[model samples]
Target: MIFYGKQNVNKVDIEAVVSVLQSDFLTQGPAIEKFEQYVAKYCGAKYAVAVTNATSALHIACLAAGLKKGDILWTTPITFTASANCGRYCGADIDFVDIDKKTYNISVEELEEKLINTDVKPKVVVPVHFTGQSCDMEKMYRLAKQYNFKIIEDASHAIGGEYKGHKVGCCEFSDMVVFSFHPVKIVTTGEGGMVLTNNKDLYDKLILYRSHGITRNQDLMTKKSDGPWYYQQIDLGFNYRMTDIQAALGYSQMQRIDEFVTKRRYLVNRYNDLLKDLPLILPYQIDEANSSWHLYVVKIDFNKVNKAKVDIFKEMKNKGVCLNLHYIPVHTQPYYQSLGFKQGDFPNSEAYYKEVFTLPLYYDLSYEEQDYIVQCLKEVLE
Candidate 1:
């Protein structure tokens, strides 16, 4: 069966991992710094802190942004819970804005209205780059400047994407940006993530936060060391460090990010052409953005079809097409429902949940496989 998403690990990626296994240090070593440098340089950011996963990256970013009790953190409910859970991790009050019908990112117009009308100002606004397509960050940044709130870009789906001709993780429009390297993501480190920023202070804070807030650097320590072996827990932090083994794999994957993105875009274009006649609304890319195309989702017009999305999904799966939905609306989850969030809290997100499903998309998905998948989809629709 064709998978909706997958990792494309070649001999080079395996060799890199083997090399790290033979090295002296497996964790908190040179490979970690090398991977961080590689991502920072590629994304055009001044500094990057590597961590175990994107959730940790988001948590550290929220902490660095000074989110705390009584602070409001706003994000789109269309994303994974990690997007808003990170705010809760900091003891901050979480709120959500609806998504744009076309972009599937946070609605910039709604965001502006919310900011103007709400009595409590948000400490940070996380604009998720859903499906690897960037939100209108330039406009969001303009609003941020006017309202005095920080921007934390949830760029987990957009490592190789470009926004307004700049790399998505450059932190040009946001105060901080986070990336993921999960197996099914654009890049894979087995399991890893990174936080990018142009600010030195945030970079320093991220370093401290990733490793239990301990500092061996004499400059950061409160007092001088008695001997060579001396460290201090400067602040409360977590064990979120990425191992050298993971970093090595991530570094190797970084070498082919451009190629991976190119192939994914090719598949997206092919899907756009081949599926245009189908009763589905295909993804739209704005002129200013070049997506990494991590996912290719189409919203089915359930009104036109007699079958429900669940029935169509089962039919496609029975035909050997392993399709999956990108997400359920985060606010509609049982956990979020306990927080007073309900189904209709965000209408666009709820609407998206009913109709959208992801197709097979990865570096190694063949044309024949894609053709078969589309043929099965057409049959299922009929």
Candidate 2:
């Protein structure tokens, strides 16, 4: 069955990992630094810190941004829980900003309205780059400057994409940008993540927090070391370091990032051509942003289609097109509900959650497979 997403690994990726296995170190080694440097250089960021996964990357980035108890963190509710959970991990009160109905990224207009009316401004606003499309970050950046808030771009779905000619992780508009290297993402690190930043102090904090807050650097230590092995736990942190094996694979995968994004864009174009006449709302790309097309999500117009979203999903799956839902509204989750968020808090997110489903989208998906999936979708909708 065709899946919604899958990893594209070739002989080179395998060879990279195998060579790392033959080396002396498996966890912390030269590959890690090489991978970090490659990503930082590619994304045009001054520094990058590699971690175990995007969740850990978000955690460390939030901590580095000075998020703490009693501080409020805001993000779109239409993303994976990690985008919001990172703020919660720092003991910050998490809140949701609605998403744009078109791009499905965070809505800059709603964000402005929220910022203008609210008494207590958010300490950090995480604008998620949903489905590989960058948010209106320039506008968000303007708001951030006016309100004295930090911007943490949740760019988990956007690595090879660009916004207004700048690479998504360039940190041109945000204080920090987070990337995911999960199998389904643009590149695979076998479950790894990276945080990119332009600020030296935040970069240092991110590095410290990713590895149990321990610092071996003499410049950061309180006293001179008696031995070469001396270190200090500067603050509370977690074990979120990426393994060398993962880094080697990631470094190799980075070589094909452009190729992967190009293929996905080709598929998205084909899907748009084939599925335009169907009773569904196709994904939209903003004029200033180029999407990586990490997901090709379509919303079934329930009024036109005679089936519920679940029924259509089951039908497609049974027909060998294994589609998936991108997310449920984070605010409607039981955990968020307990936090005083309820069904009607964000109407747009709730509406989106009911109608949207991700189609087969990945680097290795072929034209024949895509045609089959489209045929199945047509049959399901019919």
Candidate 3:
């Protein structure tokens, strides 16, 4: 069956890993820094700290931003729990802002309204770049400056995407941008993530926490520290380092970054062309941003469709069109409900969760597979 997303790996990817295995440095070495530099330069960020996964990267990034108990963090309700869980990992009180129906991203207008009436203002606003389309960064940044809150862009789905001509990870309009290089993402490091930032202070903090808060820098070492080889634990931290093997894989994948994004866009265009008039509402990419098209989600019109959404999904699956759901409203989950978030707290997110389904979207999904999926969708809906 055609899965919703799949990784595009070739000889180059495997060869890169083999080369790393043949080398002396397998964990901490030149390859890691090489991959980091490649990503930093590509995204126009001053620094990129590689971690084991995006969740770890998010954790370190939030901690570096000074999030802690009593501090509030806000994010969109319609996203992977990792977006909000990162805040909770730092003991920050998590809150949700509803999503806009069109882009399925955090609504800037709703965010502004919430801020106007909020009692304890958020210390950080983590706007998720859902489906590789950016949130309203201009409006969000202006509000962040006014409200004295930091911005952590949850760009896990948008490494190669762009907003207003700037690359998503540039961090020009936010405190930092986080990326996930999972198997399904545009670039793959098997299971890895990176945190990009322009601020040296935040960069230093991220680096600090990423590797057990240990520092060998003489400037940061204890005043009476022993020898040149001595190190000190400056603060609380974690073991979130990415290995040289993963970095080598990431570095190789970086070469095809543009190719991967271009192929996904082509596939999305094909799907749109074939199914735009069908019994569904296709994803809407913002005109101001160049979306990476990480997901091709469509909302089924239950009233017009012949069968129940579940039956339609099952039929598609049987036909080898492995459709999936992009998300469930995080606030509606059992854990979030226990946190006091009820069913109707975010109307748009709840509505989105009810009807949306993800179609096959990835670089390796060929034109033939897309055609088959579209034909199967048409058959199922009819």
Candidate 4:
């Protein structure tokens, strides 16, 4: 069966994990720092803090940005719930701006319109880079400066993507950026995440937030805390620290990120050519930006054919092709519905959800397998 996403593990990756298992420090160790340094250097960011997963990274980012109860946090509805749930973790009110039909990212025009007219001032904006395509960061940065809102880029699908010819996590256009290291990402650490930022204060806060807020910082204590054995819980935090074993795998995976991204791009080009003549709409490129091609999503022509998305989905599954949907609109979730969100609020997101399906596109997917997938899709569609 062809999977929509997968990890490319090698003997070297296995050996890296084995070495970590035989090492002295398993949790908080030098390997974790090494992994953080590797990602930070790759992204050209000043600091990178490793966490248990991308959700935890997002949570810390929101907390460090001072999101609190009654504060508004805005993002695109077409993303994983973690994108908006992180704000709710900090007790902040969460809302969403509709997405652009072409880019599948938040619309800057809609964002500006909401900010200009809404009674509730937003404390932060978390723009998700869906399918590894970056949002319009320069425009978002300008809006941030004007509206006095912070930015936490949920770059879970975009660690290797470039914005304006620079790494996405350099924070050139946002306050902070978060990355995922799940097995299906560009690189794998089993399960891990990182937070990148240039501001030292936010960096320090991220460190504290990842580990129960218990800090040994001498300067942060209320009183002159004791020597060599001083620590305090300044604010509430979580046990979100990443393990050294996971970090070791991440460090090894970092070496091949460029190669992985290159291969994904090649495969996407192949798909674009093979499926161009089909009754489907292909994903449009984000202008002037380089994507990592995390998922190859195409919109089926439900209007052209009598077959709805569900029929095609069931046929693909029955044929042993594990094609998957990227996501449903986060605002439509039952949990979010209690927050007063209703259908028809974000038409573009709903439309994307109805027709979009991710094809089998991963680093390890072979050329022959792809041809078979295309052939099968043609048989099903035609």
Model 1 ranges with Cα > 4 A deviation? none
lDDT score at residue 42, model 3, on the 0-100 scale: 95
Which whole-number lDDT from 0 to 100 does residue 92 have in model 3? 89
lDDT of 1 by residue, 22-137 (tens): 98999989999999999999999999999999999999999998899999899998888999999999989889999999988899999999989998999999999999999999
What is the lDDT for 100 in model 4? Answer: 91
Worst 10 residues of 2 by lDDT: 308-317
The residue-by-residue lDDT of candidate 2 on 10-63, one tens digit each, is 999999999999999999889999999999999999999999999999999999
Which residue pairs overlap in candidate 4's backbone? none
- lDDT against true structure, model 3: 0.91
* Candidate 3 TM-score, C-alpha based: 0.98
User: By lDDT, is 2 or 4 better?
Assistant: 2
Higher-scoring candidate on TM-score, 2 or 3: 2
Give the Å shift of residue 52 in candidate 4: 0.4
Which parts of model 2 are misplaced by more than 4 Å?
Answer: none
